[model samples]
Target: MRVEMEFLGSGTSSGIPTIGCDCRVCHSANPRNKRLRSSILFRVGEGEDERRLLVDVTPDVRMQALRANLSSVHGVLITHTHADHCHGLDDLRGLYWGGGRERLQLFAYPESLAQLRRAFGYLFDEDYDYKGIARFDTHVFEHEPFVVAGVAVTPIPVVHGNMRVAGFRVGDCAYITDTNEVPDTSIAKLKGVRLLILDALRRAPHPTHLSLGKALHIAQQVGVERVFFTHINHDLEHDQINAELPAWARLGHDMLRVAIEADGRISTDEGGGGVAPLAF
Candidate 1:
């Protein structure tokens, strides 16, 4: 299956510029320097049958979609309940209503769904309606595999200290975010993937997120043909990191497009895909 994976956001939870800090990456002239929190969009099939699966609806989700010229969606797969990952979900209400209203399918673990319900009370509350628009369905995920719009998805469970988050293995492309360490069980779940997009929050150690070194170790251990680091911070400069990385590994930037062919061949291009940044 040919799938188009778009990086909606590649920045950390704080994002670039980080609200007043004067960092070089935050002030760089390169468009890739402007990033939102980590999120992605998976477009499968073509034409009318095309299915859009959102990895995480970050706070910048609306602008990200707007930047990429995406207006409709099929479902959402949340990694965790972090605000940066799920706050932008409210914007999806517009997608539910074009001429009329229609509910969309939402996939996540019980806890993540609970977080969504708690965070966005209006969507879950039947009594509340925003200009005659509101609807959604929740599919609780266990450790088992499932399908969303005909694409088989395997959930990989990783640890963020005491908490557990579900990373996804969609086709040959596996995406794991906000992870500090991947236990043996999670590693088993991630193995044999051709393209792995794992979290690398920064160069220094973080309490909850993986540093660049740890991320690289996990990528090497997974033994995937190619690896791309995401959830980046301003501490890791794009040019500096890319220059030191092995040919197979890359520091993912905003608007990066990763195409996985039916034969599991992985091809990615940030400059040639005509993919514009979702925001400035």
Candidate 2:
């Protein structure tokens, strides 16, 4: 039951090299610093049975997909309905058609789905005309375990600002993004997880996102074998931060691939400039 998770984009809302900002990380020569909006794709299973679950379709999703050479997407899981997390959803029309599926399955909490319905009335509203638009068959889950394409997934509820969002645990890894706090109950749900991809917005604290110090604290509490910080802002330079971090943790970058084996072995590419899907 091993699975692989790929950091499609690791930057915060504005993304790296954000417009009009002349910060050092933004202009860093290292490609790792050139991050896009936060998102991840989980490859569950292998060969023909493989299912790729896309989490948080950011505004940069199109570019991220192209960079990763993702030939298809099996399903989409939204952490929340924030603009950066789900804005690029419409851009996935081409993927839906290209994958030759009748409709893409979308899994999210009730509140987020309601927001999606409002945002994309054309896609979900039965009253709207169905021209040639790609459809998303929405599935709702709330603080429970669900299955997608035969893989079991546990939803971990976390607080983001004034709202609650979901983080998912599939196999041995749990991904929590854009959340400043993970409740004690949710931490209990993530007990056996060996790998954690948690949000660490920047070196400084933010109201809604976890700061580096807090992220480290949570990772220690989770007692994960390894952790990679995501939802990064440009304040922390990639290489410099890694140099400062302990052996168990490092800042994640765009296109980073982490593979876990059934026996609990974990391996990574440091993004290795991203490897194309096997279909390529």
Candidate 3:
């Protein structure tokens, strides 16, 4: 099977070129240095039969969708309901308004869903006066792989400080963001994944997100040859970090498209470098 993953937003909560910051990465002219909040999109199949699953609904979702020319969002897979991750819940109403779906399909852990409901009460609340097509059919998933648009997505549970969140495995690629610890049980599920898009927040150790060294260690434990680190902070410069990494790894920037095959082959095209959609 072939799957394409697009990095809609690859930066941390505050994003790169953070406000009031005078860092070198912030001042850099390279497009790769620029980033939005963290989120990604998965694509499978083609034409009318195509399936798209969005992971996370970052605050930057509107801009991200416009940049990717996102056509349809068949489903949404949320890791957790942190402010940065789920703040775009309001922005996604437009998808339902414009698309053909009667109700948007969304999947997340039970607690994550609860948090989202509390945060965006009107979306799930039945008493609201606004009777719009922007409602959702929320599906709660646990450890098992759930089907989204004919694709089986396995939830890989990991710990972020004191809270539990999920990373997902779809086909040969696994996308995990906002994580610091992947327990042995969770790490076992990632053994055969050809491509891993993971969290590498900064150079220094963090309580919730993985540091550069720690993320690399986790990658080694999983034994994935090609890895794209996401949820980056301004501390690491794009080019300098890539130079320091092993050839199989690179710091993913906003709009990076990665293609992975079932047999472990991987190819990538930087968005600013060129147009990189295989099936779109």
Candidate 4:
């Protein structure tokens, strides 16, 4: 079995350029630099069957999915109920409900489920016909192991100020976003992970996000063989920041992909032709 992950988006709350500020990285013509909020797609495959899982649905969800060429989404595991994490959920209607109307499955915490229901009652209201008209069923988490698409997922708990959010550990890869700190219990669950996708907003401290230094510290604590930092901001340029990280730690880019094998080992698929780096 091989599990693959694609970085759907890797920008902060407002994304790059801030909608008005003319920062160099934001204004740069590099398409890779053009980010669209934070999100990712996790896929597990065996032989010819592939199961796809999505994490977060920022306001840019529709465009992001289209750019990634992902036609169908199997499930969504929300990290938190923040607007940036759940706003684009309505777009799922296009995929979830088609000519026949099929509902999507959403896995989230109890509080997050409540917020989603309240904010988008039209999706829940049987009478209301959404512009696209999609339906979704919610599953509550208990910070324990659960199964999605036949893959076992262990929910790693992290604190966002006073609120608790779900960070998932699937196979040997853990994807955690919007987290400043992971408690001991969660840290225990993340041990020996081959690849860790962590929050590294910037170099400075933040109230609810892990700075570069803090993210590195947490990665060290988790002792993952290869750690990739996501949920970044324009402040951390991709090219310059890679030189600052350890050999096994790098800043994740907008389209970076990682593969985790059945034994929980991690690597990247370079389109089957490039030479892989040798360990020193």
The positional error of residue 18 in candidate 3, measured at the CA in angstroms, is 0.6
Candidate 3, residues 193-278: lDDT per residue as tens digits?
87899999999999999999999889888998789999999999999999999988899988888977545468788535423232
**lDDT over C-alpha atoms for residue 137 of model 3:** 91
Mark the regions of model 3 whose C-alpha exceeds 4 Å error after superposition: 131-133, 261-264, 271-280
Poorest lDDT segment (10 consecutive residues) of candidate 2 = 271-280
- lDDT string for model 4 (84-153, tens) is 8889988876657532455677899988999999998888887775456687777888867888868788
Model 1, span 94-191: residue lDDT tens: 66663146577789989999988988888888777456545887898989999987888899998876788889887777889998889988888877
Q: How well does candidate 2 score on lDDT at residue 51? A: 85
- Candidate closer to the true structure by lDDT (higher is better), 1 or 4: 1
The whole-model lDDT of each prediction reads 0.82, 0.87, 0.86, 0.80
Clashing pairs in 1: none
Clashes of each: 0, 0, 0, 0
Candidate 1: RMSD over Cα atoms? 1.8
Candidate of highest TM-score: 2
How high is each candidate's TM-score? 0.94, 0.95, 0.94, 0.91
Candidate 4, superposed: residue stretches over 4 Å from native: 97-100, 129-131, 262-265, 269-280
Please report, as a residue range, the 10-residue window in candidate 1 with the lowest summed lDDT: 271-280
Q: List the residue pairs that clash in candidate 2.
A: none
